[model samples]
Every structure is written in structure tokens, then in C-alpha cells.
Target: MDSFDGFVTGLREQLDGPLPGTSAQLTMAPSYRMTPEQARVEGKSCREAGVLALLFPDGSRVHVVLTVRRDELPDHPGQIAFPGGQREAGESLRATALREAHEEVGLQRDRVQVLGALTPLYIPPSNFCVHPFVGVTAAPPALCPTDAEVAHILRVPLDHLLRPEARRREPWTLHGSTVDVPFFAVDDHTVWGATAMMLAELLAVVRPLYPSLTIPS
Candidate 1:
């Protein structure tokens, strides 16, 4: 079987098992649900979209690619995030994801096979309802970040994410409201906010099958 199939099989098996009791997992699968109107009123009106690259080298080890947004951007500047943007006119979400991926990180469609999508997320600060789609590339990518939008390209080892210690939470005061934001510390770099939320959900879905998958401590 192809590596992608094997990975998905393993992922499914892991998710079917017991759910981890990590903070990341708990926050992603919240205790309460938000209504559509409530979600919209809570700065979720911004309709921005994006993609997540579930890149597997030689279709084996599943790694995730994130970009550091340029400091000049008004929102989410200098943050480690998935390479994605708003959907342009007459474009499909998949197409938009692929196009934005290429523009931001020089990822060619030929290298990636569109797998499917995860649930959409609403980011409050940016007012964007970000849609994260998962795609797998056969080979390791030659990433080139856009100078103006992307400051750096991060190819985070999947194993690192699977390690519980690499991910954590910290206190943050946003618009005078205090809360704990999820953060992933891979080496010296930190990943938080919506990007971390997506990662948490990704882990939720993929963790059931991979028994050895690590949960953040």
C-alpha cells in the first residue's frame, strides 16, 4: 500500500482508541457548542480561508509545514501559521488552498495530492472563518516563502508534534480578556493561536490510531 493510505489507516486506528486528556485535546473539542449567530457576532464574520499541508516525505513520515507571517501584515504578523489566504473570486476552496500555498511557499500542485478537509475554524482576532484542508505531497518540498507575506518557512517534524513536551499553553490578554492560548514550542520557535487550534484538532482526529502518539504535557 501507498504511504498515504498507511498513514490514514494508522491515524484512524488511533482516533478510535481512547482520547487523550491533554489541554490541547480538551480545548479543541470543547464542552459547549457555539451557535452560528454567536460565532458570527464573536468576530468570526471575516471569511478568510487557508490550507494545511500534511506533507509526508516519500509518503512516509507525516510532517506539517507552517510559515512565519511577515511583520508588516496587520493581523497574524510574525506568527507561525499554515500557508493560506482568502478565497479569490470564482475559485474553489481546494483551488484557493493550492493557489495560496504556491504563492506563499512555492508549493507546486504536481507535488501534492489533495486528500480531504478537516472542520473549519473561526479566528476571532482576524475575524476570519479559516477553512483548513489537508493535502499530502509525495516528496519533500522545496519551499520558498514569499518575501513580503512569509518571513520564514518551517517544516516541523511530525514526531516533534507527537511529543507532548513540545506543545503547551500560556496566558494571554486579548482585548482585555484573559485566557490560556495553546502553544507549541518546537526547539526555540513557538506556535500559538488558531494555528495551534488546528493542530490540536488534527491531533484529535489522528491520535486514535497511533497509540504511540504523544500528547502535550
Candidate 2:
């Protein structure tokens, strides 16, 4: 487990350094990706939100926990996303991330060792400014999704995303505009938009440490 410890150590260190930020996020971003100026010009009031990218280890490989929203959810229905939602009044973004993870996926906050946060992103479609936090659970979590919001729970091996074939693009029409969308294909789910953007930074931070990990293909 030297590699597992290394992954955790590397994550904590990278979070303290200058992040890849929007440049890396934009690599996987769609053409419709909103800019801060546009958000201001639209005069849209956005709710503050937070999400957790929680990692775990199974044997020598590291995995991240994600959730697919139920098709009936009012916002971003049927989309694969990190477990999160708008923060309550007086709640810290970090607390929001931990709390949402617990409520949606039954991940006990006490079990999570939060590393640090990634760059905050604004989602035009949802009108939310999402703060993404990186965290880890020493043992595999007993994750159970709330039937009201979650449709599936995905435990994706992090190394799977490091491969050349992990990223792909497709044409899609959004709000009457056609754009080429880059997304990561996990299982049968298409992870794109703000969720993919957040993952982009997470991957950028984790990518450098892959050479030291002893994961099997």
C-alpha cells in the first residue's frame, strides 16, 4: 500500500499548489461552457453548491465514488454527477460537500478524510457555483443511494481514466446550438458538462501520481 499512501500524499500536496483551473477544465468543456462575465451579464442568481470526489482503494487500485441521478429528477435528470446540492444557509462549502455525500449516498462524513478543494465552477444550466472537494475513505464505503435522487452508484477505478481511450467527443445540440462535447465514458454513463469539468481538474492533479501506483489494467 505504499502506492495508496502516495496517492493520498500527492493529492494533498497538489491541492496546495497552483491548480490547472479553467484551462484544464476547458479541455473537456463543451462549447456552451459559461464564462464568469456571461454569468454576471445574465444577472442570474446562482445558489452556492459543493460536491465531493471521494476516493477509495481496492487492492492496489484507487477508485472514486460517483452517482447517476434518477431520470425523473427535475434538474440534470439522468445525468452522472458527483453527489452534491445547493448549500444551506450558514453552511460552509466543505461541509456542504460532506453533508450532501452522506445524504445522497450514505457516506458517513466521519469516515471521510477531506484532502482539499479544486477550483470552483459555475454551471450556467443549473445556475449554481459548484465548489468541488477531494476526499478519501480508508476502507471501502457501504454506499446506499437515496431512491428519491440517485439512480446508480459508480465505483470507477481512477487508472481507467488515465488511458488514451478514456476521453471522447460527440456532437450534441444544446439550447439550439450544436457543439462538440468531450466526455468520459464510464460504464454506460456519459459524464460531461460541469461534472466532467470538475473531473478534468481532479484527473489533472492525480495524473502525475499514476506512474507510482501499482494498479492492474
Candidate 3:
């Protein structure tokens, strides 16, 4: 098999075993002040959500899809995020992620192969406990973005993310205070917050498989 296929195999193998978990998530977290245990205490009654890190082969490399939320949206407006939403009744987290991806990006459920799940993260701002899953498609998806929810679809090559340079910090105002925010600079988009944290975990899992890729500690 090719390198992309091999990477998929490695990812599936990694998922089947133990995950890097909260330690990985902390690498890209906004603030290290609050630990996962602390967050759990605060998120006792948080709503549940699921997101997909959908990967597919594009030419010779693998790519992951992320969406830019429409500016008019009520939550996280104009922010880059995974295609997902709150869990629905009588559905598994995997199902919820796939359904939301289909609704937001027209990525059919059948086209995706669910690899496995990462650690669930609590978003204190939105009061959401988000469960992220890694999925793969053999071919690139023909995307159809929902104008109401998605402003643009970003298909970022995995190689780009593996590069240490892609991860950077910038000053941003939050809660009336200016703070440095860490983000992945991908395709003219600043992928920060929960999305960045999730990506960090995924990379922590797969980066070791490719010895050539250098990620900062």
C-alpha cells in the first residue's frame, strides 16, 4: 500500500489501542490552568456533542476536513470547526458525528469508515462535552456546504499539520482580556480552541508513525 494508506492503517491501529487522552489535548489547550479533572467537576451538567476528524486521500497525501462556521450562527460564529453538533435522541455518538457531517457538508455516512474515538473534551464556554472520532474515506469527498451553517470547507493535508511551523500563537481578546491563543495556521484559517485541541490529540497519535514529521514538544 501507499504511504497514505499506510498512515490510515497506523491510525486505525493506534485507535484500537490506548489513546494519548487528556495529555495530548493539553498540548493545544487554551489554558493549562484547568485540568481535565477540574473541567469534569465544572462540566457536571454539560450537553453532549460529537465531532468527526474525517480523513481521506488526496493525490499522494492524506487530508482532514474542517469547516468554517457562518458568521451569522448563534454559537462559535465565523470559527473553524469540525462538522458536528449536539447528540440526538436514540443515536450513538458516532452516528451523531456522521449525521452532522452529512447535514453540514453533504458527506454521506456510507462514504466514511469510523476508525475510533478520542478523549471527550469539555468546552466550558459552550457547556458542551464533545466526543471526537476519527474516520476515513478512500476517496476525497465531493463537498456541498450548507450555506446557513458552513461558510467554507477546508481540506488540509495531513503533512501540513505534521509540520511544527503550522502551530503558532497569536494575541486575541477573550472575556475582555487579551491572551495568547495557540492555533494551527492552515489555508488562511486560524484553527484554534477545541478544534486545535482535538487536532493535537490526533497528531499525537499519528505523528510517531511518520518519523520524518517534526512536531514541537
Candidate 4:
């Protein structure tokens, strides 16, 4: 098997054990990160949402898909995010992730092999308890976004993320407070907040496979 397949195999095995959990997720969190108790109390009535980190091979390298939301959206507008949204009444979170991906980006649900889930994170601003899942599609998806929700698609190579330079920090004001924000420096976007936290956990899980790279500490 090729390196990508071997990496997937190892990732499946690792997801079976205990996750890196909050420690890994918090690595990319803003300076105003919340405590567990705060997440619980505030998240009591928070809406549940599902997000996916969809991986696939592009040429010989593995790439993950992220979406740039339309600037006019009610919630986190003009932000980089995974292709997912709130859960339906009877749908499982995994199903929600797949369904939302299909609706937003035309991802064929059946073609994706879900490796496992990462730790759930609560977003204070949106009041969403976001559940993250890692899945792999056999091939690159033929993206057909309707432009109603998604403004653009970013297919980022795993190698780019594993490099230390992709992680950067700066001061940003949120809710009238200035806080040091850690974000993934993608092409022109600042990937921070819930999306950055989820990506941090994913990198923590997959970092072992790219040991030669100087990943951010």
C-alpha cells in the first residue's frame, strides 16, 4: 500500500484509543479560551453541530477540504470552516456531517470512509457544541457548491499543515476584548476559532505520520 493508505490505517488504530482531547485542541485556541466547567454550563442549552475533516488523495499527497462561508451568512460569516452544520431531529452527528457536506459541497456520502471522531468543542459566540469527524474519500470530490452558503473551497495539502510556518498568532478583538489569537495561515484566510481548534486536534492525531516535518509545538 502507499503512504496515504498506511497513514489512514494508523489513524484508524489511533482513534480507537483515548484521544489527545482538550490539550491538543487547546493548542490553537485563542488566549480567551474557556475552561471545561464554562463549556459545560454555557453549552447546556447550546445547539449541537457536526463538522467533517474530509481527506483525499490529490496526486500523491493527502489533502483536506475546508469551506469559506458566504459573507452574508447569519452566523460566522466570511470565515473558514469545515463543511457541516446543526444536527437534524433524528439524524446522528456523523450523518449530519455527511449530509451537510453533501448539501454544501456535493460530497458523495457513501464514498467517504469515516476514520473516527475527535473531541467535541463548544463555541461561545455561536453557542454550538461542535463535533468533529475525520473521513477519507476515495478520490477528490467534484465540488459543485451552489454559492448560497459556500463562497469558495480550499483543498489544503496535509504537508502544508504539518509545517510549522502554517501556524501563526496575532492580537484580534472579539466582543470588545483584545485577545491573542492563534490561527492557521492558509492562502489568504485566517483560520481561527472553532475551526482552528478542530484542526489542531486533527494535526495532533496525524502528526506522528510526518515526523520529519517541523510541526508547531
Which candidate model has the greater lDDT, 1 or 2? Answer: 2
Q: Write the per-residue lDDT of candidate 1 for residues 1-217, one digit (tens) a residue.
A: 2366787656545445553323343453222222334223244447768676555654346678889888889876788888888889888888888888998888887777766665566655566777777777656788898648799988877766777777676777766776666578976677876677677767666654356665643
lDDT of 4: 0.86
16-74 per-residue lDDT for model 2 (tens digits): 89988877787788866645453231344688999999999998889999899888878
lDDT of 3 by residue, 125-201 (tens): 78888999999998998997964889999999888998989999878888888877888999778999888988999
> What lDDT does the true structure give each of the candidates?
0.67, 0.85, 0.85, 0.86
Worst 10 residues of 2 by lDDT: 34-43
- The parts of candidate 3 lying over 4 Å away from their true place are 32-34, 38-43
Better of 2 and 4 by lDDT: 4
Return the TM-score for candidate 4, rounded to 2 decimals.
Answer: 0.93
TM-score of each: 0.78, 0.91, 0.93, 0.93
Ten-residue region with minimum lDDT total, candidate 4: 34-43
